[model samples]
Target: MPKAQETVLEINLKALKHNFEYLKSKLNTNTKFLAVVKAFAYGSDACEIAKYLQKLDVDYLAVAYVNEGVALRNAGITKPILVLHPQAVNFKLLIERCLEPSLYNAKILNEFIAVAQQEKQTSYPIHIKFNTGLNRLGFCEKDIDYITSKIAETSSIKISSIFSHLAASEDLNEKEFTLKQIESFKTISKNMIESLGYKPLLHICNTSGILNYPEAHLDMVRSGIGLYGFGNSEKENKNLKPVATLKSIISQIHHIEKGETVGYNRAFKSDGFLKTATLPIGHADGIGRQYGNGNGFVTINNKKALIIGNVCMDMIMVNITNIDCKEGDEVIIFGEKPSASIFAQTVNTISYEVITGVSQRIKRKLV
Candidate 1:
């Protein structure tokens, strides 16, 4: 546990370990694990999380872009870092740092091969991303032959692995779609292996994929939001612990008389005499302005406090009437109790959006 601060994001390492262990329990001993550290490890400090995951001996680390992989490399992370979306322009920097690029298209493939050959590289490892119904950045089934031909022409780069993304792994209602994706991935991978005469490691499962589609855990499994302590369902979630706790303190308490307006544009007005606590956190801290006017809330003194009035860029006023709190009382924006997922649903979103939306400017400390 960390001492309360005006505003802080506490990352519980113990919870992270628990989540990791639980997820690892779902995998076979032969399968490898990759931890997704993209989006600053979903806004919990990428470098720190990557370093810790590396210590856990994760087979791989993945990020959204080249800069993120570079950041991990600069932080002394030695695990193989995969940049999910690598532009041709950053091929030089990516190769220079030993960061792997997931070549999802022809331009990326051609451009990367050119750079690798120019650098006189031999057997440079690269991942091939195929489209398995995600309709995202990846080569389609029709392009498999062309991709194999291109790889055959290159000595500078070698196929490190092949992967695809699952579009609806979380929703049980979308089970058919997820299964179709797995089937397509299997067909494409089988063809690629026959063509190359050797099987490169194959992986397609994201966090939810690992939980819901255990049979599809090819050569490796990637854990993202799941690693952050969410399981995409009530039952799975019950066993995992939330790793990040967003906390703040009551900067002051104010007494409001009946009919008095509060905050900008009178978004909230007192109906009667009440006590409100001003918390030093707001939209800029990634809580967002829409999370106000009573739609969103915080917890104080183990009681709910509705967020009254429009959320400010740096502060929020909450109705604390009937709560036994005072100035400097600790407040929980979202954590193990209310959970980030529950809070995000109030805003018509998901846990990933809620956690990743947390502002990087806010301090993050590992416990």
Candidate 2:
């Protein structure tokens, strides 16, 4: 790719393919792959990512809301899209778009059933979510009987899969908790299978779960961060290539003398003569305010230029006194060298937050 002329996010499909194949290599030959393309494919272009993944023969796609699924459908994505958190209001639209919903509780299940029945649909695929441990969403173990009974009463919808979310599959310190969650999911699956008299597709592993727990890779595995080139650990990260590279160009250069302040609220007072490079990217572009005052740094001409003063809404000034750089020079916010994970660590956040927080206003170039 050529040097960025302006603030841009370069989405490398080759890197995405590499990450997908790498994650798939860990799964069994028969296991299915569900690419989670929610939150605009982790702040990249979801439609483009979904199109590429669909070409790669991904078994399924998942989005967090009905509108997201509808967006993919509008983008000509015909794969089975699992709406991970479908709401009652959009049940009609969800069905019209052929998007499957993950019914987690009694009210959602009953409401969806009513909508399916009203739509005169038959055997519409739906996923049942069980709250194994992630207490965020899903039915409790005790609700299995009610769920089965509710299913028995309606043929309008059918259980396509049973799934759960793992809270801490990435942290080894929570191994005991993760194992218990997996074991609980297994028990729930058994009971569900026995009650329903047939087995639905069983899956509970997310990207971290796919990396950390091989025993729990049931029928299918869902990967979000892994597909975006993060493994959630130092060892696994080495094997995955980052898919997004944020790049910008120096808009101007400024020479600051001692006692001169920079940016809003006079956040930085230069102690000595120095030069600064202003890049056209800031909080609005996802480089938050927390990454100011020497906390965050960017790469310029192969040198690390610390971000000085407070970050503005549309620009950030980085000290580049020693670096051999000029206006219009390429600047790297985060990429393979200073990966998103490393950049996010400056503000005590995670790659998921940083990557997904990128503003949609920035132009995305797919390569």
Candidate 3:
């Protein structure tokens, strides 16, 4: 248990190792695994996660930006890190840290090549991102000619991997659309590599693709959420252990008379005499206000407790009338019976958002 002075995020390194091994077991021996530690390792702690993964002999570590890669480097992580969405401004830093930048456009690729040449680098590794269907990033298949031309001129930069993102790999209902995207990537990857006279690693699979579409794991697979547990299917999740277990202590408790209201705006009016537990976490801590008014719940002694009223910035009230507990008792926001998945479902959202949205203000205590 963390000291009462601060709220802490308990990171289960054992669970993380378990999840990693579980995901690795599902992959072919030839398929390289690039653990995506972007967004602070899904808002847990990227540097720490990356360091642990480095020791685990992961094929690669991936971050969303050049700075994220630099953070790992600063933290003594020497493993190769792929910058998934690097920008032109940080091209020098990316080169300096020996981080591979994902070149999505001719402009960025040219800029990076220039930087690599200026730095006297020989064959600096870089990734080409094809916009199969994500639309948010990457170059379209039609732009393959422009990409090939850039790679042809830049002898200092080498294409390390050609990758694309699956827009909806988890949704089996979109099987046709997903297949079309995969085919597009296949066509573009083949044409560009052949034209440039170079063979780079070909990969286009997220967590879902690795699990549901094994054929899509061309040379490498980039997994984020799947490595930390929750799979595309609930049935598949049984093998992946959750790496995070959020716990908070009850700061105070109140025995309210019938008709008494709880929290701001009197959002929760007591039906009868009730016992409420005040937890030390609130919206500021990533328990969003949307979770209030009974929409979200937590576990107290393995029993469900209803959240009442608007979630304050520093506090939230849970109905603990039936629970036999006192102040300083632990109330699990997630991890136990009422898992984060279930809590997110109540508020019409997914577990990813809820877990990643957990504010950095909470100290993460890796176990």
- lDDT of each structure? 0.91, 0.96, 0.86
TM-scores of all predicted structures: 0.98, 0.99, 0.96
For TM-score, the strongest prediction is 2
Residue-wise lDDT of candidate 1 within 75-184, one digit each (tens)? 99999988899988999999999999999998889999999999999999999999988887899988889998998988898898999999999999999999999999
What residue pairs are clashing in model 1?
A: none
Q: Relative to the unseen true structure, what is the C-alpha lDDT of residue 352 in candidate 2, on a scale of 0 to 100?
A: 94
Give the poorly placed runs of model 3, Cα more than 4 Å off: 1-6
**lDDT for each residue of candidate 2 in 1-367, tens digit (9 for 90 to 100):** 6899999999999999999999999999999999999999999999999999999999999999999999999999999999999989999999999999999999999999999999999999999999987889999999999999999998898999999999999999999999999999999999999999999999999999999999999999999999999999999999999999999999999999999999999999999999999999999999999999999999998899999999999999999999999899999998898999999999899999999989999999998
| Model 2: lDDT of residue 155 | 85
Displacement of the residue 30 alpha carbon in candidate 3, Å: 1.3
For residues 110-211, could you state the per-residue lDDT of candidate 3 as single tens digits?
A: 788888899888888888998988888899888888888777776797788999999999999999999998899999988987887878999999999988
Find the candidate with the highest lDDT and give its number: 2
lDDT for 364 in candidate 1 is 90
